[model samples]
Target: MAQQDRAVQTRERIVTGAATAFYRVGYADASIATIAETAGVTKGALYFHFSSKEEIARAVIDEQHRRVFESAAEILQATASPAETMMLMCADLAEWLVSDVVVRAGIRLTTGGAIFDPPTRAPYDDWLATFEDLVGRAVAAGELRQGTDPARLAHFIIPSFTGVQLLSDVLTNMDDLKVRVGELWDVLLAAFAEPTRLDELLALRFRIFGPAS
Candidate 1:
């Protein structure tokens, strides 16, 4: 049992170290030696855990998704309002982007054209499905404007966020990611919230995330 636990720990360290290396130098430039040094593990141990850099990149992406999906699920359970759930969910994601190296590396590895296969699909499709479900629920609950199409809203929102984060990464290196996300919420509320529910959504946003700036 102890040996198994240690192995788990080692693998975790390697993933985290790989994330740091990937984030700093990107996937292509990050060599096995760099990853091993960053991870504080020997080459043999790294090779034991992962046969190749590509496999390690996939593991990092998987870990990143697991973290994000878990947090989103928690927020969804805590919030009764679908709109509120979606809002807090996104805020949590922005926070992850700012604070978590694994997430940042995963975003770069998956979106930066490092991996060119199936796992390369951004956290995007998953979020789109989730957003669409919540939007549908919000429309049903009268949280959004009448006649709003959930699929349309979901598609627009995901891309809008993608653009916001991409630009934030390019310009500020995401120094202002949370701020950009907050601003994005403002625009979303203006466009999506029902007239009668707009003020409520705005208030909820303030309570949950403080303020855009």
Candidate 2:
């Protein structure tokens, strides 16, 4: 049991180290030697856990999805209003993008898949489905204006958020990600929110981005 636990810990350490390396240098520049050194494990150990850099990258992406989906599920369970839950989920994602190396690296790799062969689109698809579900719920509750299509909204939102975060990373190293996301919500809410719910939805911007500064 102890040996299995130790092995799991080692694997986790390697994944974390690889994530940090990938976040700092990007997938093309990140090397296995650097990942192994950062992980404080020999190359042999790293190879034992993951056969290749792509494998490690895949693991990091999987971890990122797991963390995000778990958090979203928890928030959905606790929040009755689908709109509020979606807002909170966006805030949480922005926070993670800024603070978590695994998420940052995973996102970078997922979107910038030119470096990987046979790139995976599963992450984007999964997020789109999640967003569609939330928007459908919100529309059903009349939180959004009539004629809002959940699928179309989700398709727009995921790419929009991705662009905002990528630009934030390039321009400010993500220092402005939270504010940008709040701004995104501001525009989106104006377009889709029911007139009666506009004020409350707009106020959610403050909860996410904090006071003007």
Candidate 3:
């Protein structure tokens, strides 16, 4: 168990280090030698775990999706209300986008061309499909309004996160990010929540998303 744990930690360290290195420097510019060095392991050690740079990149992205999907599932399982569940999902995604180094790297990779690959897109497609199914469940539960399309809701929410990711790459100010995200959530809540629930949702915006100020 100890050796297994160590191996897992080492692999994770390599993934995280490679992700940060790739994000800071373009993947085209990053080399396995450098990644190994950044990860504090020898090139042979890296090779023992991952045969090539492409494999490492894919592993990093896969781990990122694993974390995101796991978090989403946990959030969904914890809540019975669809509205609250979706809001929490968005919040969790946004929080990771804003904070996690690995996820930020994955976002960059997605926009940079890695997502065009079949293996790269597979996990993402599965995750999105599952999330959409959750939205469908919400609709069936009557937590969402009539005619609410699960795929459409997933489409809208996913793009919002990616849009923020693109903006984060260019916009250096975190304060502006908070305001922009708050406004975006306001628009989303307005569109999805019942009219009678708007005021409560307005309060929920601050509660879930935090203060924009």
Q: What TM-score do all the candidates reach, one by one?
A: 0.93, 0.95, 0.85
For model 2, residues 1-213, the per-residue Cα lDDT tens digits are: 698999999999999999999987878788999999988999999999999999999999899888988988898899458888888888899988988888888888887878777887888898899999999999989888878999999999999998999999999999988888888887888899999988887776687677543
Q: Pick the candidate with the highest TM-score.
A: 2
> Candidate 3 versus the native: TM-score?
0.85
Question: Would you list the C-alpha lDDT of every candidate in the order shown?
Answer: 0.88, 0.88, 0.75
Per-candidate RMSD vs. true structure? 1.7, 1.4, 2.6
**Count of backbone clashes for each model?**
0, 0, 0
Over the stretch 57-127, how does candidate 3's per-residue lDDT look in tens digits? 88877877788879988997894476667767767766776788888677677666643465356655765
Candidate 3 achieves a global lDDT of 0.75
User: In terms of TM-score, how similar is model 1 to the real structure?
Assistant: 0.93
Clashing pairs in 3: none
Model 1 Cα shift for residue 68 (angstroms): 0.9
